[model samples]
Target: MEQQQIKLVVLDMAGTTVADQHEVEACFAKAARMSGLEASDEAILAAQGLSKRYVFQLFWRAQLGESHPDVETQVDKSYAIFKEVLEAHYQTQPVFPTDGCLKLFSYLKQNNIKIALTTGFYRVVTDIILGRLGWLEGLDENRIGNDDSIIQASIASDEVEHGRPAPLMIQKAMRLLGVTDPKHVINAGDTPSDLQSGNAAGVLLNLGVTNGTHTVEQLIGHPHDALIGSIDEIINLIEGIKQGRPSGKTADAYSF
Candidate 1:
């Protein structure tokens, strides 16, 4: 629980460190409509933090019931549309870091903690967003840079065999960062699957931010060490840990 014991912090992209205004969810709905998949927005939003392809697959199965002759085709079409829509949005729209995201990064860097971004997005779109925010500047080919780099590392859902609600992405981030112990990592995200993923990874701390896709009531249904309204509160938790306080260990809710 000590500050020095924390070696890395794994973050979710769209809703955690990036200000997502339901854009991704909206795109998913569009893709579903375009592909003739019957899915409600609530269903798509509930699947947030899950790999987009998997989301489509789930929806296709639900829509078609069991197996259908054209299930794969429909899923593929929806997924393709989703990728195109999301890619174009990030490529054309103005992108900015979430509130206090940069300051949290600075604080982590100053404390010698590694920062890694994990997302349900594919590598292509991930790069586009990172590039727009100028967070991909110093990253190397492996996408795993040092603390001095824009971000220590970035892991996309495609890079891992499984996405959120599974530990693969978090495990991949830890491996790439050269951090061996899950007990020394913290996972902070904005969705239920994010918390489930962190819990499956057995991280030292699993936190949630309510300012993103899900509300506090939704996030509390998942297992998390703490919940906050903004990323800026991370600084306060780290500072508390530095002072020998069991700050983030308590399952309290924080909203600003």
Candidate 2:
């Protein structure tokens, strides 16, 4: 197989690129409780990279049978509350970039590789975080690509037809970045859904970062090129991928 040069890199937001102190879980828990659902942290953690609306629907359907008339309404109600709580948490909280994330972003920019942020967050919440960080400058109204901007693209879960575990976000990013071949893309995140989407899209490499919401044990057995540490570890992996080196996996460390 011919190795295609990488053109775009798609990354998850909260736990992957942004420092998450389980604030998302705390907000989600508050919303779940107010809506009469006693969801555990493990459950919420497991659904880390999924759409919040979808997560509510899943839990509601699990509690109330799928055919029950109250499922959709409860999902809507729960999601509305989640958005309120989530928005407030992010608004008041200290939001910062994850370790080595800025350096990696600069590396990609200097190499002429497009950087896109895809998050399970809806657009409003996504903007709150980006606006605070001043990372929203280059995105168009639709959050599409702009080469002159620090980030070439910003994709919110609500912007796509489907969220993680589905390839739509990654595919949409590729389209906006003008990257037709998945072989020319790289996808990285801290959750299994992130890996699945990248694998589903047939990207050049799908990576997992343990320093996020999940641990190495939690991320193992997923179809990923390797499980790494910080976001910046990707710099070496990108070089290896571009040079036709298939970075292999190892235990507990950055195997890529």
Candidate 3:
């Protein structure tokens, strides 16, 4: 069998690789209730793809009149509570990798393609989740080893100059991976912001998966090169692209 010529694969965490949406929402609700605020589901959904600190700031500003009273302190408290909730649930029901995740990752690794993990999660929370999943082994120092076939160049929403709608993270990932041409890379995620980031980064492919909070229709309107139901579909699309098959229209070519 001929090897595919995929250079890099950038994956988003949270809903894309792990199914922690329910847990994340529960934690946010618990934190909001502790602060004597009632956070609506719509509010929580809108806060998706933002850092926990930013989410807390949004809630604090809405509930407490302003982001005053020390926004960092409030963020710290909310995150602490969120971690407690995560630990309680994770202790009994640990988060497992999404279906076909292991197999797909193994396949990509075997093919010697570079893998980059990008997420809106903070380093603290990301560390905990990766540790639980045994992904920490790859994080020795700032650069994860490619010998394991999985590399993470995640830019936390807080760490970057701008999150999502901006392409700094993806650009940094490409630079680190030595991929100069955007056409040699594929960015996969479950949100419109993910597609936007990939598009802004000038990546060759911006793939959106419906496994996240967004519906297929919602993603269709976004600037994604292709929309699929899951990451497994992304793998199939990559195979098709490698085989000289048409992968459908560019995001801009689609009409709503």
Candidate 4:
């Protein structure tokens, strides 16, 4: 029997494929305060990988009743501020790929593995970040890229009915990329939510990166196939899968 081969790699944007220097947190902190809600850095950090709008709503609903009269108002106001701040930050600040990001892309290209980026960000900011990185170069008006392009496709949280921890984005990505089997896809991100979504999708490998928003200690106890040290380490794991043997020499390659 022929061994199953990976055909798609779905990656998260902020902190996973893109270098984040607390820029997102700065924006979120501003929005959190602007909404007249108090959220600590720890709270905000824990909310990473979730839809931005959902995060605000979550915080607001937590503070107030789910049906509070002011919930929608606060969500709207603070999200607007977040958009302004985030757009300004990305427009003025430089954006770059994370460590080994290009290397992984090149490897996937060489092997014909489709790449899709899923984000907690909405479409406007997602386009901003992707455009800044020139990853949106060849995509059509539909925002569908391809392996021949920098990326194949991108799914923003707002595009789907549900976001991370729901598998909607991953399922949408698989549908968009023409992939049928979760056993042939690898989902990777920098947050526990990423793992949960991948698990929900039942992908071949649900992976996490420690070099991003979450540390090894933070990601432990999360259901995942592996929690690697960096994005580059995935090359090793994939190679092992291809070779039918895993040396597993890289520390933390599959820890929790």
Q: Compared with the true structure, what per-residue lDDT tens digits does model 4 show for residues 1-256? A: 0234788899999999999977899899997887698788998999899998888898889888898999989889989999999999998999999999999999998999899999999999999999999999888887788657989998999999999989999999999989998888888999989989999999888888888989988988788878887787778877877876532224447554
Q: Candidate 2: misplaced stretches above 4 Å?
A: 247-256
Model 2 lDDT on a 0 to 1 scale: 0.87
Off by over 4 Å in 3: 1-5, 65-76, 87-92, 152-155, 246-256
lDDT of 3 by residue, 135-252 (tens): 7676656645555635545555666787786887777777877877777788888777888889899776788877677778867878877776677665666676666655423333
For each candidate, what TM-score against the reference?
0.95, 0.94, 0.83, 0.95
**TM-score of model 2 vs. true structure:** 0.94
Q: List the residue pairs that clash in candidate 1.
A: none
- Model 1 regions more than 4 Å off: 1-4, 247-256
Which 10 consecutive positions of candidate 2 have the poorest summed lDDT? 247-256
Task: Report, for every candidate in turn, its global Cα lDDT versus the true structure.
Answer: 0.87, 0.87, 0.71, 0.87
Clash count for each candidate, listed in order shown: 0, 0, 1, 1
Clashing pairs in 4: 145-152
Question: Which regions of candidate 4 are displaced past 4 Å?
Answer: 1-3, 246-252
Residue 83, model 2: lDDT of 94
